[model samples]
Target: MTRDGRRGEAADDPVDDATLALLLEVAGTPKPGNVDRRRDLDDLRFEAFLGGAVGARPGLERAARAADPGAPSVGDAFVRAVEGMAARAGTNTQFGCLLLLVPLVRAAADPDRELSPDALDAVCRATSVDDAVAFYRAFEAVDVAVDDPPPGADDLDVRRGSDAEPALRERRATLRDVLALSVDPTDPDRVADRNAAEWTEGFPRTFRAAEWILTDEGPLADRAARAFLGLLAAEPDTLVASTLGAEAAREASERAAALLGVDSEGPGGVGDVDAIPTDAVHGADLDTAESLAERFISEGINPGTTADLTCAALFVALRRGAEVAP
Candidate 1:
């Protein structure tokens, strides 16, 4: 529950380090525009894998239900698509793949509009290979940028061995393992690595990225929601007046806060708020997270709960296989 990384400027703004890695890789590959090139949204069958997981996210299933069977909302389409990815990969995952297909999901939901290219740009601007090389070069220009912590900086979060140099070697080892070949099969952090790898070959972006973004995060009732948002907010049309509105993400955020006995914004009729359990420390997978999520949805969703429902559904789809970090 400790805050991770720096403040993100905004949800659905641009790709963070994670998504950017996927995007830049896609852009460079033989199939940069493949997701876009697909003629129709439903024609893409990745939805079957998503199944109930998509239905579990906040707003996703309701949007699909509201839209008529052959038709689904952007949120609905995205969650289902991620479900499909998980099912196909033959593994458990939260389906963060939903993020990559955001443009496609929004486009499918909106018969009136095509998801814009800006979403892709948001990812590309951060990486794009050419930029990465420049970034590394820039880092080289700075002096005293040693991989190891200096004398007084031992208090830094970085782990060190007998001394700093050995620690740098260990750091490199971690990166290497995180970036290792697919013979072990589970790891693939950067984009360039996926293409060259033996096992991750020919898989959709959903499966490729979901390992870290969704599954590896560990399971806690809260994470299912985070995974869903990570994927849904990627949709081209998902960016709204504000991500902090009374939507699924906000509701999920509130639920997480309340569980921790923190402040939550809602009507005066406050219901029973469950205390965070000791086991929840192990995270979502260890908890009956999906069921708790369903309870959260039932209590919070009213007639006008379309947005919230869809968001939660998306969350379920993305985080299904993920776990909370220990």
Candidate 2:
């Protein structure tokens, strides 16, 4: 992979798997409000996502080459990936996914360590203040919908992008520290930052959903679709909450839970239900899912965060030996 838009030689590589995961995630049909093979959003088309995936290969390769002395850090790789992705897509396509995948790809580069929560956590914990600055720079490369910063944290607003770099440097914030700001919110109404939570908390949802994708017996695309539904049902999408409201995000999850015939609520609260049963996911009512997809798109509700998590899960599954076959 080169900046000149030429692909490297094909071989067994985690970068290839990561790129495939992006394609499979977008290709999965009836992803409900996402641009999948069967449908496209008004502003974003399916082709852009394909171009984004192809364009992101250089950054993925950089992350996978962590052993190289000159390899970019996780945050630098992420910034490169987002810049490439936006350049090809003409907008943001997988910003959140690359945030998750960059560290995971770096963790996968360690021959002594398997791609696991602990491994990823170590990679995230090792990030420096420079990485935090790079992360903010990545945000400057594309438009990402994010909530306003908390009242006292105006200087740390992510939407400020690179403008906040001085504050981050002054505070000596690492990339993990920057993500931690979004993980535990003081305001009850603030939507949880699921991607940041994954970065700070070792990617629990991503790994769990990867297990769902691996255990389910089907085509890889169908497995990804099922995993996508399970993920959407399990949590209020952060993007939905930011774009719409918390109530709208919860309603979307509730509808997905209903389609899966599961309770959306549990002892913990909304989106704390048990793992969606494998049987239920495999036997899910596609007709109802399709109808829900139509309804969500019509209402301008897109579960973009869930889709990002699903793409990360697909990458994990692919790394763990989930094969794609006809």
Query: TM-score for each prediction?
Result: 0.23, 0.94
Model 2 bad stretches (over 4 Å): 1-12, 266-270
lDDT of 2 at 290: 87
Worst 10 residues of 1 by lDDT: 28-37
Q: Which candidate is the best by TM-score?
A: 2
lDDT (tens digit, per residue) of candidate 1 on 1-326: 21222233332222122222222221211111011111112222223323323332332332323226554433333444344434443342223333233332332233333223342232223222222222122222221111222333342212221133343344442211221221122222111222112112222223322332343343332332332222222211111212223244344444444443334434211211122232332232313333443454344321111122222232223223222235
Candidate 2 lDDT over 1-326, as tens digits, reads 32212244442467988999999999987888898898988999999999999888888988998788777888889899999999999999999999999998898777777789999999999999989989899888899999887667789898888899899989999999988888778888777889999999899989988988888887898889888888888878899999998888888888887788877564212454246676767777666788888988999999999999999999888777687865
Please report how far candidate 1 places residue 40 from its true position, in Å: 25
Candidate 1: residue 151 Cα off by (Å): 57
